[model samples]
Target: MSLLLQIETATTSCSVALAKDGVVLGFKQINQRNIHAEVITLFVEELLVSAGLKYDELDAIAVSSGPGSYTGLRIGISTAKGLCFALDKPLIAIETLEAMVYGIINADQSAISADTLLCPMIDARRMEVFTAVFSAGGTKIKPTAAEIIDANSFADLLEINKILFFGDGAEKCREVLGAHRNASFLPDFVNSAVHLTQKALEKFRNKEFEDVAYFEPYYLKDFIAGKKAV
Candidate 1:
């Protein structure tokens, strides 16, 4: 009977979902840059109204703890934290890439072979991405890290395994990894809050909650601020 409010602002998607017992009741989202700060709260309120739940009724708030955009993560985590504090509900965090793995697998797309591997990438800068590798069953076979994609990237794995490269960062890799018969790319893939349900539910059941007072997003790489305009 857990009611969870999920938010994902990682990458360019600003999404919100309200779920009951791990099932998405209602959700809304937009894939646009620099709009998270404007629409995240609106999305949450709309979901609450559509789902017939109030802030106080949420059992917990789940947010994507990211290896994604620094600003996007900040907006998402701050919004989730604000609700948790106002409602006195617990906060749960799911890794951005992990939820993404859940997203693609849950899509039930055409047969993913037993030998196929799952990898979700979040755009960083030119040629670099925040990424990880997962088994077909969604187990993390490789740790999350910031990788610079090149012809040799994942060479060993690509030799024997079919790897699916996806997310906002994957499109850029096609030129580098395309010739490999073992590597394939998923186009137009965007992260969504809906994917946070299963893991959030598991964390709620296990009482795995973050300290509301001191939680922070997993920025993966150090954020370097741009130079000030002269």
Candidate 2:
């Protein structure tokens, strides 16, 4: 059956899903910042129960390896690694931006042939993002980058066709990117584990599983914790 368990906590949302052979059997998600640590395990348990499965039954665990929230990524990676160790299973890390794109790409029947570009962005901080652009066929047009806001950053990238930018960061940067006539935004898009099902299945078949002992989330920048100035 090739059962896979997937987790995504790369942004404000915390999502988990149970799938068999690339088809989701059950899923749960909550879109609130700072809740990944609080809700991830509960959601995982819920999905397992809904799918009538157990931790030991999963063939592998797949997680969104991030260029998104630093704390959120840590919470997810730690939980996933713990399960991997306990269950004696392989772990798969999918890029956060790529997962976001997958969520958008598979959302509709029209998406398969849409000639527009898909640029998925994650809010890294004020005026910054972890983002990349992909063609309708899922080929990367612009490699993921930790970019600062600018009017012309994507000017050249949009010359070919329109782009659909969506994520936590997309709305914030829409105006700045609006100088390019071909650019548009899709604010409804959010990260989800359902998107990782097929991707994880592909990795599982190709033996691209990851070693859990040393695996870590891809926080695009160093995390810095601070308090308000007194």
Local accuracy of candidate 2 as per-residue lDDT tens digits, 1-230: 68889999998989998889898888999899888988899998888887777889999999999888888888989999999999999999999888877777778748545778888888877889898989887778788899987887787767868888889998989888876788888867878988887788889888898879888888878898878899
Pairs in clash, predicted candidate 1: none
Leading candidate by TM-score: 1
Best by lDDT: 1
Q: lDDT (0-100) at residue 181 of candidate 2?
A: 81
Q: TM-scores across all candidates?
A: 0.97, 0.95
Candidate 1 lDDT at 60 equals 95
Instruction: Tell me how far the alpha carbon of residue 209 in candidate 1 is from the true structure, in angstroms, after superposition.
Output: 0.7
RMSD of every prediction: 1.1, 1.4
lDDT of 1 at 66: 96
